[model samples]
Target: MTNSHEKLRMMMIIALFAALIGIFSQLIIPLPLVPITGQTLAIGLAATILGARYGTYSVILYLFIGATGVPVYAQMTGGLGKLFGPTGGFLFSFVISAFIIGFILEKTRFNISMAFVANIVGMIINLTIGTIWLKLFASLTWEAAFLGGFAPFIIGGIIKAFLAAWIGILIRSRLESAKMLPKKATIS
Candidate 1:
């Protein structure tokens, strides 16, 4: 069983990851449809490195921060209004993505290849949900959603996934070395 100290540390790490991602999200990465935010990258890394419980919390915290009037969301928008806006789906999808990524990583062994697959799969799931949610809000057809939102971001998504997975794997390795991460807890 994990000790209280370890659990506390886990919570701290989850909060830290959320904050880190929030900070990165504030820094705009130019894109056609929606300017890039570090949410995806951070979510991927958080999910992979921190495990599912903390990973999901990190994403939930991010949404909570945005909903609570923090101007850390994409386009510097915030509050409950943002959650109802067109981008709301994407924001909500982040939580799902984080959960899936963490679950996949926890279930499998942590290897660069497996991490890569998990990141890609998890991101795709989030993207699908976000795009579909946007469609419902805007009355967009699937073709339109795919073309308008998903298509434009494919390449960028791949790049972000690569970086997130790479960084996560590296961080996981370091944590394991320091005995902060369990050796046998992770398979492969």
Candidate 2:
């Protein structure tokens, strides 16, 4: 493909992933402090496929849409208020987490094990930032913040991480074999 075509394709893919994140955000399981959502899974998938730069761009695009009151967040919530709410840290962490996961996968040989480890590390970053935000914003004790924002989601996070890693690696492998993946984003 020509350079222009490749750039266009990359842009389109990033936009698609952004839309996916928005759609996944709606799949919410409500809780008192923070809702469990499929946003993380989409994040992982985007990172695994798009690499660090584009993956981060995809998430930023999603956040921008939500901040503009697109109702792309969990429970169909959006607006700047949502971005600044107690759950906002988690939302913000998505960017960093995606970058981390993508950078790791892009730098290393793609494999299920490494993907799993990358996802777990990303999840840890999310949880840590979210927990701190919850405690600060909600004026809760550390224990309370952990219980409300971190504890309940542990098992679900692990499951989602594993699924994301497994599915992402599969898709990536297929794309690579088909020569559809961008050379810049793949291991040469």
Candidate 3:
């Protein structure tokens, strides 16, 4: 395929995945501090599968839409204001988390379990930035921040992390079977 065609196709795929992330970013079920949604799965899975370049771009596109007041954020609301809202830190953290996942995956030869662990690591990155920002922005104590952000979602995050990693492995295996990746991609 030509470079132009590849570029267009890549753009379409990125847009499609970003839109999916945006759409799924809704369905907010309240936890302790922040709302939980399916968006992180999309982010982590996309990062693990697409590599850092496309994954980072895909998340950046998602954030751009949200910042423009497109209601692509969790709870179906958006605007630059959301970036500074109670849960804003996590939103900003998404960029780095995506890049981290993609970068680590590319650098390390992780098995499927490892890829999921990588996804969890990415989520931890998000939480780290988010909780700190939350504590600072809200002037809350560590306990308060934990209540609002991290503690409430530990179980859920664990589940999501495991699922994302498992799914990543499944997808990687399928791609390998289809001859889209090398046989050694599994690293099993």
Tens-digit lDDT string for candidate 1 (1-188): 47776777667777798888788787676755556677788889988887776788888988898899988787677899889876678888888888888778888867778788888988788778878887888788888877766777778788888888888989988987887754344333
By TM-score, highest first, what's the ranking? Answer: 2, 1, 3
Cand. 1 TM to true fold: 0.89
> What is the number of residue pairs that collide in model 1?
1
Q: Per-residue lDDT for 104-172 in model 2, tens only?
A: 887886788888988998899999999999899989999999999999988998998898899999988
Query: Can you tell me which runs of candidate 1 are displaced by over 4 Å?
Result: 30-32, 182-188
Q: lDDT per model, in order? A: 0.79, 0.90, 0.79
Better of 1 and 3 by TM-score: 1
Q: Residue 44 in candidate 3 has what lDDT?
A: 83
Number of backbone collisions per candidate: 1, 0, 2
Instruction: Report the Cα lDDT for candidate 2.
Output: 0.90
Worst 10 residues of 1 by lDDT: 179-188
Of 2 and 3, the candidate ranking higher by lDDT: 2
Q: Write the per-residue lDDT of candidate 3 for residues 1-188, one digit (tens) a residue.
A: 56676677668767877997898798578776678888888888777766667778889999999999999998889999999887888988888888888777778854677677788888898888899989998889988997788877677777877877777668756755765533332212
**Where does candidate 2 stray beyond 4 Å?**
186-188
Clashing pairs in 3: 33-148, 116-165
Best by the lDDT measure = 2
Model 3 ranges with Cα > 4 A deviation: 172-188
